[model samples]
Target: MRRTPHCRRAHQEHLGKGTPLSVIICDIDHFKQVNDRHGHLSGDRVIQEVAGLIARQLRAGDPAIRWGGEEFLVVVQASSGVAMGLAERLRSAVEHFHDPEVGQVTLSLGVAEILSGESIEQLLGRADGALYRAKRSGRNCTISAAGN
Candidate 1:
């Protein structure tokens, strides 16, 4: 939640300097079932591992926040292409994770770049809508905002 404001401020500042700002909303694929079948401890382990993987992949100064249960928000100061690439890397890392407890974990990501006159809420909403699309498309994939 706090990260949202920081992301907005960063986006606002970078927008003035002609730098693009992108946000990624990542959700664990079928996370509720993981918890139900493997227990909450296993779910916690998966969450920790996922968070670590995301943090490791981020560039210096980029923010990766645990947005909610099985969901994360990553804010990057880069073009939409760069941000999408970063998300793909994270998704691949999660896919190939060799977890002894939860086995293979996967992520669905939504990437959205800040438009010239977009608000933070609007930006997040777009990314979230993209996330819904990714989930509906069978998960473990990445989808950028419309026309992006």
Candidate 2:
């Protein structure tokens, strides 16, 4: 599904309007393995539960979107540090989240701050690179792409 207009507007307001924008790209760790081990139904339940948890934790100004299968994007009106904190919190939440059918879920997150004159593509690229770093270093952690 496409991202809602509200989600798009929030991104514009925060990233295009000169307001500080922090974008995070999160992916479930070993999600494919989960699907293989369990089943598609159980895997879907895990995705839904994690998405719900993220939506509940977000502020009114923040927006979270399911970017694609097993991946989510979070936009927050805050600085880089705040974004890192939020990502960490999300990781913690997923780690501790209990699912009777799927058990615990974990995620790796990549955070980036919108730079001056930067396009959405650039921001997303940075975040995606950071996500790769996080996954390579170890799963279930947050990585920042700023100043690198």
Candidate 3:
């Protein structure tokens, strides 16, 4: 919560090691509409609920950060395919998440495996692009980084 840069540093140790690292960027679909309809407090509750769902699904050592607002960033030390599976699982969980006040929520996710010799910015940019594609593709779905 201090800053996004601090969160990103947690994974720096494994970079340049040729490890199978991946990133997933998840965004709440139609989040503005939720805020407008349910009020900011409800929006906060929704963010908390979604964050909890994302946290529960992560394995030990993986990092899930509230990137900002209704968006989350997850770093997984796995292949792109594995990351895709994880993203899909998270999306499904959000789709089924039931809240007495907010009802069901959904997530659109973009996932990418870090390539050797790639910087964090490159990795995140790819993931973000994939996330954008997911949002464009109608949300509540996962998209893997193309050609990576």
What is the C-alpha lDDT profile of model 3 across 35-102, one tens digit per residue? 99999999999999999999899986786887878989898877889988999989998998888988
Error of 3 at 44 (Å): 0.1
Query: Clashing pairs in model 1?
Result: none
C-alpha lDDT values of all predictions? 0.89, 0.85, 0.84
lDDT of 1 by residue, 1-148 (tens): 2446768678767767877788999999998999999999999989999999999998777878889888999988888899999999999999999789778989999999988788777888899999999999999999999857
TM-score of each: 0.94, 0.90, 0.90
Tell me the TM-score of model 1.
0.94
lDDT of 1 at 139: 98
Cα lDDT of model 2 by residue, 57-125, tens digit: 788668788898999999877888999999999989889998997788899999998777776677788
- When sorted by lDDT, best at the front, the candidate numbers are 1, 2, 3
Model 3 pairs in collision: none
TM-score of 3: 0.90
lDDT of 3 at 102: 81
